[model samples]
Target: MNVLNTDVLVIGSGPSGLAAALEAHRNGANTVIVDSFARAGGQYWMQSKYGLERNDRQMQAGANFITNSENLGIKTITDAEVWGILPKYRVFIQQGSRDSIEITARALVICTGAHDFVMPFTGWTLPGVMTAGAGQRYVKMYGKPPGDKIVLAGSGVFLWAVAATIVKAGGKLEAMVESSSNQFRLFSLIGRHPSRWTETRRLLSPVLRSGVQRLNGYRIDYAQGEDRIEAVKLRQVSNSDRDASQELEMETDCLLVSHGFRPITEITALLRCEHQFDTKKGGWYCKTDPETGATSIDNVYAAGEVTGVTGAQSALIEGALAGLGVSEKLGFTRNGIERKRARLMKRQLRTARFADGLAELFELNTNSMPRIDDNTLVCRCEDVIWGDVLKSWDDGAQNLQAVKYWTRLGMGRCQGRICGVAVSRLLANQFDLDPRIFGFNHPRLPLRPVTVNVVHDALARKSL
Candidate 1:
C-alpha cells in the first residue's frame, strides 16, 4: 500500500473541483485533485469535440490557472477512483484493479458532480434509446454518430443541445419533444401557473435558440423495432387539454431522453454524511451550508453536483467557495480573503437561483418514473429484473429498503450508485407507501474498491 499526504484532497476534476484546487493552492494549502475520467475537463472538456460541445472559456482559464504546480501547488490525478472513507480521514482508493493507494488529508473537497436521470419507459431498454448526455458522449468523446436520423426528446437545455449537435452533425431531427402540451394550454394555465410559466421561459430560451421543432406534452408510448429502435410512437399528454388530442409518430434511428440530473452522492453516502432528499436537485444531496459548502463532517466539504445537482456554473462557484472555506478552516489564507470570497459567493447565489428555476421544470415526471417492466432489468449490476422486485413487492415488501434487501438490488459492486434512486421510487409506487416513506438506500464505504494485496498490506500497517 502506497501512502501520500496532502493538506487538502479534492475529488473530481470538474469545473468546481478545479476552482477548489486553485483556491486551495493559492491560499498555500498543499492539494491534490483526482478524477475517474481519463481527462481533466470532467464532462465538458471530455465532451468538448462533440458537435454541440461548449467553448467554456472560463473553465479553460481556471484549468490554466491551476496547471502551474510551482505557482499554486495543485497536483491533479486522473483515472483514480476513491473506494472508501474512514472516520480517521483515511481514504482507501484504487488507482486501477491491482494498484492501490491510501491518502490521509487534513481536509477533503468533493466535487464529483451529478448524473442525468434515465426514467424508464417501454422500449427504453432498446439499443436506440439513450440519454441526451449519452448522445453528447457519443459526439464529443467517441466522435461517433448515434444515428443519421435522431429524435431529441425530453425537456431542458441538455436535450436541445443534443438536438443541435445532431442536426449540426447532419443528422436529421425527426422531432424534438417537450412535456408541455400546446400553446393554448399555456394561456389557460397562465393565471394559476405563474411560477411554472417563469421556469418555462428560462428553460425554453436555450431550447428555442436551437431551432428545433417542438412536440409539446407528448409521452412516448415506446420505440418500434425488434432489436434496434426504428421509430418512436408518442401520444399527446394532457396539459390544459381534457383528452389525449393527438398522436405523432416519427422516424428516427435514435431517441434521446433526459429528465435532468441527480446528484452523484455515492462516495458521500459511503462516508455516512447526513443527507436530505431534495427533489429540486433530483436526488439525495449532502447536507451543507449555503455559505461554506461544509457538510456534517468537519473539514470535509462537498461542492458541485456531489452536494446537489447544479450546473457547471454553480459547480464552479460552489467549488471555489468550498476551497475558500477550506483555506479559512485550515488556516492557510491570510487576512482580507473573505472579501473576495464573499463576492464570488454572491455571484454563485445568482447562478444557484437560476439553477433552482431550471431544476424544477426539467425534473423527471413523477408519473413516468417507474421504469420497471415485467422483463426489464432494474439492477444492471446484479441482473435483477422488474419481475424480481415485483415478486418481492407481492411478498409484502412495503418499502424500498425492504425490496432492496429481499432482492439484493443494491448489494452489488457499484452498490446501487446508479439504480438505487430509481428503484426506491418503483418500490414506493408498487407498495402504496405514502411516497413520503421512500427511504434512502445511499451507498456505503470502503468507498474505493481494494484488492487482497492492498487490503492485506493495509491491515499489516494497522498492526504497526
Candidate 2:
C-alpha cells in the first residue's frame, strides 16, 4: 500500500461529492475523491459501467459532470471501498478484494449519501419485497425490473418517481400506494415553490397517464406467499388521528415500500461527529454549519445527504460551500471567496425551504410500529422475531443496546445499519419515549465487512 496525501479528500462521488471536488480544485486545492461504486454519479445518476446513455436528463447531467471532472485535475478513485478512518484524517481504502490504499488529507468533506429507510411491516422480509430505492436502482442502473408487476407503496415523493420510471420502462405496475393522504400539500408546494412545479409534474405524468390504481393513505399491512410475494394486504387510513381500517388486498409480483431515506452516517459516526435526530430530515444526521459545512471536528466538513435528506440540487450547493470552506481553511484564498460563499448559502436556504415542505408532505407516522404477527422477524440478520424482542425486554433488557445484548438485534452482516432504526423505533414506543432517546447503533470499524485477505494486505502494507 502507498500513502497518498492531498489538501482535500471527499468521501462520495454523488452530486455533492463531485461538486465539492470540482469547487475545491478550482479554488486551488489538491483534491481527491473516492467512491465505492464503479461510476461517479450516485443513485440519482447511476450510469452503468458498460456504457453511457443520454436518454434521460439526469443521465446527461451525470455524463457532463464526469467529463468536466476528468479535466479538472482532481484525482478520483472509483471502485474502492473506504473501510476505516482514524485521527489526523487517515483513511483506509480497499480496491477490489486484495489491494489497499491509504489517504491523508488536510481537510475532509464527507458526502456519503443516504439509503432508503424501509419501515418493517408484516411479511416485509419476503423475497420479492424491496425498498423503493432498490427498485429504482434495479430499473435505472441495472436495466432490470424487480418483477413483472410492481406494486409501489411508501411515503415521500420518490415513490412516484420510481413508479414513473417503471411505467416509462415498459413494465407493468400493479398499483401505486402512498401513505400520505394530504393531497393539498402538493398544491401548497406548487404555490410556494413554483420552480418545482415542472419537476413535480414530470415525475407524476407517466403514472397518471398510465391510469394505474393509485392509493393514498393506504399502508401495506402485509404480503403473503410461500417463498416470494404474491398478494399484499392494504389498510386505508382516513386521517392521521385514525387507525387504518378499510382493508384491501391485491396480487402483485413485487412490492416496493420505503418510508423515506436515512442518511448514511457510518463514516461521520466513525469519526465521532456530533449528530441530531431529525425525523423530518430523515433520521440521525451529522450536524454541520449550513454556511461552511463544517462539522464539530476541526478540518473535517460534511455535505449532502450525509448531513440530511435534502435531495440532489441542495446537495450540489452544500458541496460547493464545503469545498470553498476547505480551500479557505487550507490557506488557498481565492478572490471573492466571501461573495461566493454568500451566494451558495442563499441558494441552500431556498432549496431547504422547499425541502422542508416536501418533508412535511411525506413524513412517516413513527408513532407506533406496524401491526406484526408474533413470528414476524424484526432483525433479519439474527432471525430475531417480535416475540424475541418483547421477551428480551420482559427479561429486563431495556433500551436498544440492552435488547441487542440479549438477542443480538444489531449484530449481523449489515452491522446494524438496516435493523437499527426499526429496533430503535420499537423500543421508543415500548418505553413511551421519543425514538431519539435510544440513539443510533454505535458503529465500529471496519464499517463494512471485509475479507481476511484484504485485512492482511492492509496490515502488511504498513511497516509500523
Top candidate, metric TM-score: 2
Over 1-464, each residue of candidate 2 has an lDDT whose tens digit, in order, gives: 75799999999999999998988999899999999998788877778543434456667788899789988777889888889887888888888777778898888999999988786778898899999988987877666678988899877889888887787767788898888787557888878888888888888888889899888878777888889899998887654643547789899889988888889999999888999989888889999998888999999999999999988889999999998887888888778888988888888888999899889888877432345766888889899898899899899987888889999888998878888887787677656788887788778878887777767766786621
Model 2 alpha-carbon drift over 4 Å, by segment: 49-52, 238-244, 366-369
Summarize candidate 1's per-residue lDDT along 70-129 as a digit string, tens digits: 255467777777877776578776776666677899999888888777766667777888
**TM-score of candidate 2 against the unseen true structure:** 0.96
| Segments of candidate 1 deviating more than 4 angstroms | 47-71, 167-172, 181-212, 239-245, 367-372, 429-436, 446-464
Using lDDT, give the best candidate's number: 2
Model 2 score (lDDT): 0.84
